[model samples]
Target chain A: MAQMKSANVRLEKLNKHYHRVVAVEDVSLAIEPGSMVALLGPSGCGKTTCLRMIAGLVQPSSGEIFINEQRVTRVPVHKRNIGMLFQNYALFPHMTVAENIAFGLDMRGVGKADAGKRVTGALDLVQLGKFSDRFPSQLSGGQQQRVALARALVIEPAMLLLDEPLGALDKGLRESMQVELRALQRRLGLTTVMVTHDQDEALTMADRIVVMRDGRLEQVGGATEIYQKPASRFVATFLGASNLFSGKIETRDGAGALVAVAEGFGLLVDGLSNEAREATVSVRPEAIVVEPLGNGAPRTEVPNSVVATIDQVVYRGFINHYYLKLPGGSEIIAYQQNRTSEGASSFAPGDKVIARWDASSNHVLPNG
Target chain B: MSGRLEGVGAWVLYCVTAAMMIFILAPLLVVMSVSVSDSYFVTFPPQGFTLSWYAKVLQDRDFLDALQLSAVLAFSTTMGSLLLGVPAAFALVRGSFLGQSFLKSLVLSPLVFPALVTGLALLQLLSSFGSGDARLNLLIGHIVVTAPYVVRTVVSSLQLMDINLEEAARTLGASRMKTFWRVTLPQIAPGVAAGSLFAFMVSFDNYPISMWLANSEYSPVPLVLMRQLVNVFDPSVPAMSTIIILLAVVGVLILERLVGLRRAVAI
Candidate 1:
C-alpha cells in the first residue's frame, strides 16, 4: 500500500567452497538501487550460487554482504527481509492461493483483518483474485508462478531475487511473462537480481548483465555494450556467434593496429592499443556482408575484405546464413536479411564470394 | 484373427483375477456365515440366521476383559510407535552422520527379523532385568516389531516430499519449527496415518509375541480366541473373529474419512 524503499546491495569478495570444490571465487559486485541485474551464465558457472549467497540461503565462505548499507552476511534467511522466487515456484500444496500469500503476513504477526485485505490486494495484483480459494494443483504453471510472485511481493521486500523465474514455462508464455515481469519491476522500482542461463532472457529483461564463467565474473555491463564490445573470446562466442581471426600485429600507429593473418591477408582494428604484438579479433555474423566476386560488386577499400568460397547455405525465414571457407582452410560465417518472401538467393554452395566488414566492426581481444 | 485371440487372452486374465479375489475372501465368508448360524456346531452351509452367538460372546466377562486389554494395548502401541518412529524417520532421512546406513538398518531390522524370535529375546532380556510385569513386557515387544512399519512409511513419505517447500517457507519468514508445523507435517500426513493403521492392526491381531509375554491376568484377544477355539465346538469363535474384523474395517473407514484411503495406502 505504501511506496517501497528499494535498497542498494553490495557483495565484497564473496567466496564459497564446498569441501575442496570452489563454487564462487572472490566475486565482488555493487548493485545500484532500483535496477535489475541478471546473473547470466551456463549451468554450474556459479550464477545461482551468487544469487543464493545474496539471499542468505547459501552462506559465503569468506565475504561481506550489505543490504541498504547494513551488514547482513551473518543474518538468518527469515531476518534478511528479502523475497526469493525459486525455479520450481514452490507453492505450498496444502494451502490455498490466499492462504499461501497470507503465510508470510501471518509470520510477520499481521492481524487477521489487515491480512485479509492485503491478501485480497495481492491476489488482484497478480490478476488471480477469483482463484484465491483454489488449490495450487488446480492452477496452471503460469498461474502458479504468478501466485508465487504475489506471495513474494506482498511482504514488500526491499529486494527481489529470482532464480530462473520463467524457466519452467513454455516458450510463448516465458516470452510474455518476461515483458510483464520487467514492467512490474520497473514500476515498483525494486532492486532485483535474477539468475538465468538463457541469453535471450538476460538480454531482453535486465538493465545490466553480469556474465560469469568458472566461478568468476567474466564481464558486467549494459546488455548492448557487453554484446558489442565483449572482453574475451568466450564472451564473444557465448553471447552470440562470431567469426574469429587470430593474427600477429604487424603495424602500430596513431590510427590503429594492423594485424596480419595468413600470407597476403591482413585486418585493421580501430581503437586498440599499440603495445600488444598479437591478438584475436572477432566480428559478428550479422555485421559481415557477403557478395559474389564476379558479379561486378563494388567493394570498399578496407583491409577486412577476404575472398572465400561458399561451403553451405542455411535458409531461415527472415535471414540466410552463409558458411564460407577461406584460402587458408578456415571457415567464416555471414548472415544476410531476406528482404523478399523467397529469402536470400544471392549466395549458394560452391559460389566464390567476397566477405567483408568495416575496420570499426572488428573487436580486438587478448591473445590467451 | 490376432485381435480375436487377444480378446480371448484378456478374458482369461480377467477370469483368473476374479477367481483369485474369491479365493482370498472365501475363508472370511465362511467364518462370517458360521457366526450367524443357528446350528449347534460350526457348519459351512448355515441352516438359519441368528445373532445369538454374538449376544453370548458380548455377555461373557472373560471375553469382555480380553477385548478391553487388546484395545488398550493396540491403542498404546500406536501412540508409542509414532513417538519413537516419526523422529527416527526424520533423522535417518535428513541427517548426515557416520554409520547412518548402519543406524537405518538397525531401526528397520525388526521388519525382516522373525517376530517370534524377537518376542523370545525380549522375554529373556526383561526377566534378566528383573521386570516381571506382563503388560509392560508385551507392550515393549509389540513396539519393537510395530515401530518398523511407522519408520518405513514415514521415511518413504519424507523422501518423496519436496525439499523446496521447506526452503520457501523459511524464505517467507517462517522459523524452522514453524515451517515444519505449517509445511512438512501436512504433506506427510497420509503416510503417518497409514503407519498408525498398520501399527494398530498388527498389535491387535498379534499372536506369537503375546504367546511369550502375555499372562492369564493380562491376556490379549488372540490368545483368548485360540483357547476358546481349542475348548469349544460352537459358533462363538467365529463370532469373536467377526467382531474383530468389523473393528478393523471401521478403523480403516475412519482413516479414509480423515485423509483419503487411496492416499493413505498409496504410500
Candidate 2:
C-alpha cells in the first residue's frame, strides 16, 4: 500500500549557534526515500536541533536543507508542508478530535465536505474513528498522540517528524506504540525522522540510526553497524552494553589483530587491519560464553579465551549477568540465558569461570 | 484535649470569617432593601415592600441618560484597553527587549497611582490640549485607569500558558500569525474576558475620574449618583445604587459562566 513519494532529505553542513553555545555543529546527513531515520543521543546532543532545522522551526546558523533535491533552507515552517508530532502531542484543548485533524485542511481552504472526509479517513487511519466528537482532555495520552498523528497526516505532509513521540508514555505503551508507529510509517511510505534519547527505541524502529555527541555526529549507519561495528568508543558504550578493553595492537593476522591487555592476557579481535595498531576493542556481554574453569566441556573454536573469577552475578528474569574479573584485574560481563528445563548454573560471586568468544565477535573502535 | 482545643479554634475561625462576610455584605443588603421600601425616608428596616422607587428611577430621563452614558463609556474603555493592553502584555511577556522591566512597570503603574491623582493629571493634560471636550477627556482618563488591569490579567494568563503549544502549532504547518490566533489566543481567552470585565466595571463605577472629567452635559452613573446624593434628598438614590450593584453582579456572573470564576480571578 506504500505509494513511494520521493522522500529524499539532504542536510548539508547544518550549524546552529545560540550566542556562545553551539547547539548544533557542522553536520551533514542524507536520508533515503521511504526510510525512517532516528537521531539518537543524550539530552542536548543536537538531535532535537537537527529535527527542528529540518522542520524549519529553527533556522540554521549555516547550511542548506533539501527535500527531494529541492533546496528549502529559507522556507518557513507552514510552507514546508511537514508534519510534526510533539512530545506532548499538543492537541488543541478547545478543538474536538475531528476539528483538530481538520485544522490544516481548513487553513488550506479545503471545503467542508472534503475536509470532513479527510479528517474521518485520517482518524480511521489511527483507529480513532469513534472519538471525533471528544475533546483532547477526554482522551488518554496514547489516544491524544494518535489524534496528533492523524492531524498531521491529514494534511499529507511531505515528511513526518516525531520529537520524542513516545517519551511521555508508560513503558508497555511506549513499546507497543513504537511498533505500531513503525508499521504505520512503513504502510504510508512516509519519509520519517524521529528524535529520541532511548537507544532501544532507535534500534527497534529506525532503518538507520545517527548517533550524536556534544553537537557533533559521532556515527551514522544501520542498527547492526552502529551496535556491532561502532566507529568510536563513545558509540560502542552509548548504543549498548559493551566491555571495552583499552590496549595497543601487538600483531596483525589475516583473520584479526592481536592486542596486548594491561597485564599478561592477550586479546584477539576480528576485522582489524595492521594500520590499526593503537585501538580499543569492544566485546558485547551477550557474545561472551561462560563455563566453569577446567570443567572438561567441549569448547567452541573461538580465537580468544580467558579464565576469570566471577565478581558478581545479577540474576535477571530471562538471563543471568556475570561480572568476571581477569587475572589482571580488568573485568568483562557475560550473560547466560535461563532455560526452565536445563536450569541456571550455580555460578555465584567469587566463583572462577572460563570466558570465551570468537575473534569475529570483537570490534575494534577508534579511541576518542 | 489537644483535638478538642483544635476543634474549638476551627469554630472560632469560622465565626470570625462569618462576621467578616456580614460586615462586607450588610451595606449592600441595606441599599437593596431601602430601594424597595415604601417609606420616603431612608431607614434601616423597610416598613413595606414596593417597586415604585425602582420604577421612578427607571423612568427618570436624567437617570436613563446617565445610565446610557455609563454603558457607552464602559464599553469604549474596555475596547480601548484591550487594543492597547493585549499587545503590551504580549511584548512584555514574550519579547526580550532593552528595559523590558521598565516597560512592564510603566504599563502597570496606573494601578499604583491614586485614581484622583490620575484624574487630575488627565484633566490638566486635557486642558492643555485645549479641545474642551469632556467626553474625549473622560475616555482618555478611563483608558488610562483600565488599561493596567487588562495588561496585568493578560500577562499573567500568558505567563501561565505552555509556550511549547505555540511552537508545536508552528511545526504543524501554522504560520506565526496563525499560531497566535489558533493556539495562543484561545488559551488566553478567559484572561482577556476577565480583564475586559474588570475594565468595564472600573470605568462604570469610577467616581473620582468621572467626577473630575465629566461636564454638566455628560455624567456617568456613579458621578450622577454622587451628585444626587450630595445635592438632593431623593429616596430613588438607593434604587439607582441598587441597579448599579445588580449590574455589577450580573456582569461578574456572565463573565464567570463564559470562562470560569476561579480562573478569571487567578489570572
Candidate 3:
C-alpha cells in the first residue's frame, strides 16, 4: 500500500454568490496539514457552502483554493483527488461494501487484483472486514456509515472532506461514531475538513473549530478558548448558554475594571479594566455558586457576589438548577451538583440567597 | 364475532377483485375462443373448436405484411422516443431554467389530448411539412404519442433516486460521463425499462393515429384488421386479434419481471 500524503488546505478570500445572494463571503482560512478542522455553524450559515467550495463541488465566484500549496480553484471535482463523505452516506445500494470501496480504485485504473486487497484493508480499518460482501441495505445505519468512510479512505486521497458526515445517525450512534471517526482520522493523519451544525460534535472531533454565522467567520479556536474566552457575543451564546450583563466601564485597575451595570450595580470584571467604557460580560451558569444567606461566611474567596431571591430549584438528574432573581431584576442561574443530599436540601423558593462567582469568570466582549 | 366479520369482509374483497379481473380478461378470452371455432361464421358459443382459422390468418400474405409493418413501426417508435425523451426528461428535472414547467407540460400534453384530434393534427402537420412517406409519417406520429410515457417514467425514477450518489461518484475520481453512466443510469434503470415497455405497447396497439397516417402500401395490422372487420365477418379476424393480444400479454409479463408490477401500477 502507498503511504497517504496528508495535505494542508488553504482558502484565500474565497467568495461564492448565487446571483444576488451571498452564500459565502470573503473567507480566508489556512488549515494545518494532518489536522482535522471543523466548520461549525447553524443551517444556512454557509459552512456547507465553504466545504463544498473546498471539495470543488461548488465553484467560488472569486478568490482561490490551494491544497498542498498548489492552486486547484479551477480544477474539476474528479481531478481534485479529494475524498468526501455525504450526509446521507450515499452508499451505492446495488453494490456490496467491497464494491463500493473498490470504486475509487477502479476509477484510477487500478487492476482488479490490487483493488481487492485495498478494499479489504479499508474495510478492516473500519472494523467491518467480515461484512464486505454484504449490500448496503443489509447493514445498519452505523454499519453503512462505516462503509462510506471506508469508501472515502480507500482512495488514499490528499485531503478528506465530510459534509455533515454523521448527521443521519440517531443520538447514541452519532456520539459513538464521532469518537470512532476522530480516532480513525488521527490514525491516518489525513487533513480533514468536516462541516456540521452540531457544536458538541465539532468540539469533540475537531482539532480546531472555525465557527461561521451568516456567511461570515465568527470565531476560530479550540473548545475551551471559545467557551471561556469567546471573541464575540454570538460565539458565547451560540456555543453555550451564557448570562450576559451589559454595562459601562467606570474605573480601571491592575486586577480588573469596575463596570456599572443596571440598578446602580458595579461589577468587578477581572480582565476588562481598560478595554472600553461600554461593554458586555458573560458568565456561564455553572460558574455561579449559590449559598443560603444564613449559611455563614463563604469558604471560597469569591469577590463578585449578588444577593437575590431563589426563584426556582429544578431537580434535574445530576444537578439542582437554582434560578435566582437578583436585585437588578436580572435572572441568574446556578447549578449545584446532586452529589450531597445536604446541599440539595439547603435551598427553597423565595429564600434569601447570595450567588457568588470568581471575578475571573467574567468574560467581557467589546460590543454587541 | 369481530374476527368472523373480518374474514367475511376479506372474502368479499377477494370476490370483487376476481370479478374485476374477469371483467377485464373476458373480451380477450372471447376473441381467443372465436379464433379457435371450427364454424365458418363467428358465433358466441364457438362451435366445435379447431385451429383452421389461425392457420388461414397466418398464411395470408397481406396479413403477414401488415403484422411485419406494425412490428417494425412499433420497434422504431420505441427506440426513437427513448432516444428523444430520456434526455429531455433529464433536462427538465435537473436543469434550473425559466419556462421549464411549461416545456414539461407541452411535452406531456399528448397524453391529455384526445387521440383522434392528436392523430388528425399530427397528420396535417406532417403533410404540411411536405414529407409524404406514409410510413415515416406514421413512425413520427407514434413517437410523438409515446414519448410522454418515457418522460414521465424517467422523471419519476430520477426523483426517487438519491442524487448524492452522483456526487459521490464524481468525488471518487469518476468523470462526469462515467458518474452518470455508472451511477445515475443504473439507479434510474427501472424507469427507462418501464418507459420503453409502455412506448412499445402503445405503438403496437395504436389505432387512432395509425388509421389517419398509414397509406395502403404501409398499412399496419390494426388498420388491416379494421378493414377486414368492416368488409366481411370472419373467424380469421379473431385469429389475428388473438395473436396480437398474446403479444401484448407477453410484453406485460416481461415488463412485470423487469420492473415490478407494483412500481408500474404506482406510476
Instruction: Pick the lDDT winner.
Output: 1
Q: What lDDT does candidate 2 reach at residue A89?
A: 89
Q: Each predicted complex: what DockQ?
A: 0.45, 0.42, 0.51
- Candidate 1 docks with a DockQ of 0.45
Per-model chain B TM-scores are 0.92, 0.92, 0.91
Q: Candidate 3 lDDT, tens digit per residue, A1-368?
A: 34478899999999999999999998999999989999998899999999999988899999999998999999999999999999999998777789889999999999999899899989888999999888788899899989999899999999999999999999999999999899888888889999999889988999999989999888888888878888888888888778788877777787478777763465677655454677788888888888777777633223467778999989987888888897778797888787755555578899998787877888886445
Clash-forming residue pairs, model 2: none
Instruction: Give model 2's docking category.
Output: acceptable
Off by over 4 Å in 3: A1-3, A270-275, A295-303, A340-345, B1-19, B260-267
Preferred candidate (TM-score higher): 1 or 2: 1
The lDDT values for all models are: 0.90, 0.87, 0.87
* Evaluation by DockQ, superior candidate among 1 and 3: 3
Interface RMSD for candidates 1 onward, in order: 3.4, 4.0, 4.4
For model 2, what is the C-alpha lDDT against the true structure?
A: 0.87
> Which residue pairs collide, candidate 1?
none
Of the two candidates 1 and 3, the one with more favorable lDDT, higher being better, is: 1
